[model samples]
Target: MNKSAHWIIYVAMLLAVLTVTVIVSLSVGEISIPFKDIFDIMADKESMEYGILAYIRIPRTLLGFAIGGSLSLAGAILQGIYRNPLVEPYTLGISGGASLGVTFAIVTGLHLLNIMFLPLAGFVGSFTTIFLVYTLSLRKGVLSVNRMLLTGVMISFIASSMMMFLMSITAVENIHGIVFWTMGSLNESNTTMIVSMIAIALISLVISYLFATPLNALRLGENKARHLGINSNITIRILFIITSLLTGVCIAVAGIIGFVGLVIPHITRLWVGSDYRILLITSFLSGSVFLIFCDIVARTIISPNELPIGVITGLIGGIAFIILLSGSRKNSRII
Candidate 1:
């Protein structure tokens, strides 16, 4: 089939899956409301079912979708900019930085002052680490992709060690909460937070889409892009900042949900080719579907008890990463 036709079909399929997942997620909670009753509850806002759906399920689902999309889009952008298929927010240490910040807040008792303080600390940590990586990776005023990758990896290791130390020293009662936060969750999601996240995701996705042509040019190498009238340095800097902000906000809201940013972009690329315009949109939708599916599994796998969303993603992503690595090695040998 032609690429355009394939793109349409893929998007349609993703939308269908996302719709089904949302409905199933809403209906299959501990209470087990019927699917038909879900709609009826939506129709009648005064009902208790309406309250449940509106206050909890709907907001949580929307937030999950938005955060998932943001992470995937950020991953796609980073991979394109760096020309590295293996790069992701976690690889670049952004999520780790956020995790560290949240851990600090929890250990220091800043969470008691205001619920917003935790995410605020997360954002601060993310941006700070991003800047550090950027500064450290610069060589003669030019950003070196290899340097950046190495710096990010080293910084992530440092952050993880620091996080572990803090966890060890923390009160036993707070350790579970810290561990869960690192693993990620959507239990705290509400309408206001969901709306804000959606807004941020939409804006960032649009901006990233607009940079499609430049990003495509960048794939050919920096000098070539500059010869084609694209400011490679400035573009890279701007995109780096944008992706960092998107990723930081996502981690701040949902904690360090692993693998969505890494896996979803690679998955989308298989279907859509490398055109950022189409790739970005597909990644966003596919990511939304992927994470919502994962979240459903997290919620339902243990019945009344729930697993952290990160644990589910980690198990799945780790296996997928191994498969992809093996496949890539085989392809390289064949070539």
Candidate 2:
């Protein structure tokens, strides 16, 4: 098939899979409703069982889809920016910082965080990490990937330590909520978080998509990219902004969900090659699929008890990442 035909088929298949998965996700829980009744409830034609479906299950399923897609796409962008196979949206300590911010909000009796303020704290935390990393990495107007990576690692350790301190000081009753945030749950789905996350994801995707040419130029090395009329400084700065926005927004909504960003792009690159155009788009879809599937397992594994979505993702992602690393190492040795 031509590339167009392939894209059409892929998109159609993804939509179908997502549709079925969403329905299945909605139908599951303490009460099992038949697929037909679930459809009817969605159609607004109504049955006595529609109440719980409408009020409860739908929001959760939708949030799963949104957060899954957003985090995956964010990971794809990070992979491109760092030119690293393992980097994810949270690789820059944005998520750790956001976690700290959320923990702060929770402990401070900030009612807004439980609702709207949590995302704001996440944004603050995310940008602060970005700012610190940039400040530390920029010396004599030069930015090095190694410097950025080291800074992020250091910041993550510090932020995580702060999170632990807050957890220790927190009251036993509220510790559960803060601890849950650290573990990463998609449980706090609401219309507000959904809207905010979607907006950030879409904006970041659009901006990053526009950077395909520049990113490709970047792959040619800093000096070579600059020779081609690509401003390395400008491109890196834009990339930093985009990554911060994506990581911040995701942490705001989902609270430090891991591995999807780190693993998704490397897998996508295996099929889509090095072209950012195809890489970013496919990464978004595949990342969404992978995350939603993981979420499904999280909700179903213990039935009547939801596992933290982050735990399941981390387990699977960690294994997959190891395999990829092994393969990449073999490839490097061959070259």
Candidate 3:
């Protein structure tokens, strides 16, 4: 199929999946609201059902969608910039670093500072990791992809050790909360969190989308992109800022939902090729759909007792990654 035709199919599939997932999520929550009730609530918007639907499910579900989509979009930018298939949200240790911030806040009883402190600390950690990786990878003023990957791995290991130290110092009673947060949860979706995440995500997505052409030029390597009138440094700077912001905000709100960022972009690339224009749009929509569905499964699989959303996402994402890799290898041999 032509690129346009393939893109149309992928988008249509995403929309269909999104619609089904949203309905299933609303209907299958702990309260057992019926499917018809969900539709009626949505349609009428003034009834009692509407109040329950709007008040409870809508905000949380929307937050899940936003969190998933934002992380995936950030992943696309990261992968594009580094030209690496294995890079992911955890590569920069952002989520682990964020978890450490939260742990420190809890251990020290810094609840007042909790509002923005955790996220700020998370950003500091991630930027530190990024800079260290960049510095380590630079040799004679050029960044080596292998060095960057190695640096990220080493930094994550170090950050994770710091996180363990924080956890060990905390009291036993507070351990559960810290552990739960690290495992990841979407239980804290509120009006404030939703609004903040939406604003940040929308702005980042717009900026990333607008820079799609330059990103495409970037894929051709620094010298080639420079020859084509693209300033590689400026592009890298912009992408780092935007992707870091997206990653920071997401880890701040959702704790540490892993693998969606890594998983969704690769899937989108497979179905839509390397064009960031279509890849970006499709990744956002499809990532949201995937997360909501995973959440619904998380709630229903044990009923009354809910599993962590991160657990479900990681499990599904790991399996999906293997499948995609196997198929990619097969395709490569065929070509």
TM-score of 1: 0.94
Error of 3 at 89 (Å): 2.4
lDDT rank order = 1, 3, 2
- Model 1: per-residue Cα lDDT at residue 217: 95
What are the TM-scores, per candidate, against the unseen true structure?
0.94, 0.90, 0.88
Lowest lDDT 10-residue stretch of candidate 3? 326-335
C-alpha local distance difference test of each model? 0.86, 0.76, 0.77
* Runs off by more than 4 Å, candidate 2: 1-9, 43-48, 112-114, 327-335
Residue 277, model 2: Cα distance from true site in angstroms: 0.8
The alpha-carbon root-mean-square deviation between model 3 and the true structure, to one decimal in Å, is 3.0
**Best-performing candidate as measured by lDDT:** 1
| Cα lDDT of model 1 by residue, 1-335, tens digit | 88789778878888898899888888877777888777677999888888778887788788878988898999999999998878888899887788899889999999989989988999988988999999999889999889989999999999999999999999998888788888899776456778899999999989997899999999898899999999999999899989988999898899899898888898778667788868888899888888888888898899789999999988887788667767866432411
* Stretches of candidate 1 exceeding 4 Å from the true structure: 1-3, 328-335
lDDT of 3 by residue, 107-156 (tens): 77664555566555555656666666667777887667667677777777
